[model samples]
Target: MVRGKIEIKKIENRTSRQITFSKRRNGLFKKAHELSVLCDAQVAAIVFSQSGRLYEFSSSEMEKTIERYVKFSPDYFVPGRPQVELYLLELKKEMDIMVKKIDLLEVHQRKLMGQGLGSCSLAQLQGLETQIEKSLRIIRSRKAELYADQLLKLKEKERELLDQRRRLREEEIRETLVRPMLPVTLHTGKDETGSACRMSKHSSEVETDLFIGFPATRL
Candidate 1:
């Protein structure tokens, strides 16, 4: 019968899968041997059963063939350590950090996304303006209080200085008032006693220029 195409995957039937594994493994080793003999070449083949049996054929020693496979296989083999795996790990780390940054940026963008600055109603804007004005007023009040306190201090200092100046002037006046008297000059005229009294007194004389009975030095 012309059978329909089968999907190229593992057969689920246990007996059929074992039969296929045996047939394919034998065919693969037979082809490897023929090619090695006919072309006068080195060849190696290794196969593993589903139950962990290792089958191998080689033109040279099996161990030597395995060593060559490990050194030359490009897909899964690496010498000592894998540089490609280390690079992939570093790339994964960078991608993880980039993902976290993108998440944070998304959250920030959501917070500010819909604030249409030009679409707010006039009353709402006015309220905001009023709030700002109140804040400014409070600040100005605090500044005025500081200015007033400074002015009060300056005025108190001014009053103190004025008081000190007044005290000094009073001291000067008192000292002047208690000073010794200076010599006097007089212009005499005719008195009520019908005499021209020229009043003068020497320091050694008696205090008797008896026109009005007041001493000339006292006058």
Candidate 2:
């Protein structure tokens, strides 16, 4: 017969209860073993009966198996492991703690998640808002200070470069003032006819003006 279903509340008959507990305990352990074998699970089961006796089974090292059942990811774990979700039942018992004693996130949750303290005053909101505003102000001030320092350093560098260019130009001007200057090209001289004409252009900037000094040919 399929005898898996049974009453859940207190058993009025002590002997019947004892018998049921033994039967169920054996069945439970058998099921645990079957599950471990069938699913290739590293499983552990621990039972403490009404008589305070312990019965346990582990498919692998009991500690390792149990630890695997309580793994946590990184993000939700603010200060420690996020495995506190595993302790939900325990946390529920201590739900009535003083507001100051809880975590900031928990308080934030209560405030935002509609699960926080029953009464929040306008003054409290004002205080929290004030802190937020102050934090923003401090951040902005620090950013401005950093920006000012960077701008000052950049301006200093720019000034240094400008001064270097100015010094180079002044040195060049001084060298030009001291060095021998190249002779300049002259305009064309007139022939006996007093006409200005283009001359034989040489590779040099120095030009020569030829006069037909005194006419060499006469008719």
| Predictions in order: lDDT | 0.74, 0.70
Return the TM-score for each candidate structure: 0.31, 0.37
Q: Which parts of model 2 are misplaced by more than 4 Å?
A: 1-64, 67-120, 184-219
Q: Please count the clashing residue pairs in each candidate, in the order shown.
A: 0, 1
Name the candidate that leads on lDDT.
Answer: 1
- Structure candidate 1, residue pairs in collision: none
Candidate 2 at residue 196, lDDT? Answer: 46
For model 2 the TM-score comes to: 0.37
The window of 10 residues in a row where model 2 has the poorest summed lDDT is: 194-203
Instruction: Compare the candidates by TM-score and give the number of the best one.
Output: 2
What CA RMSD would candidate 1 show?
A: 31.9
lDDT tens digits, residues 14-52, model 2? 999899888988898899899999999776778766754
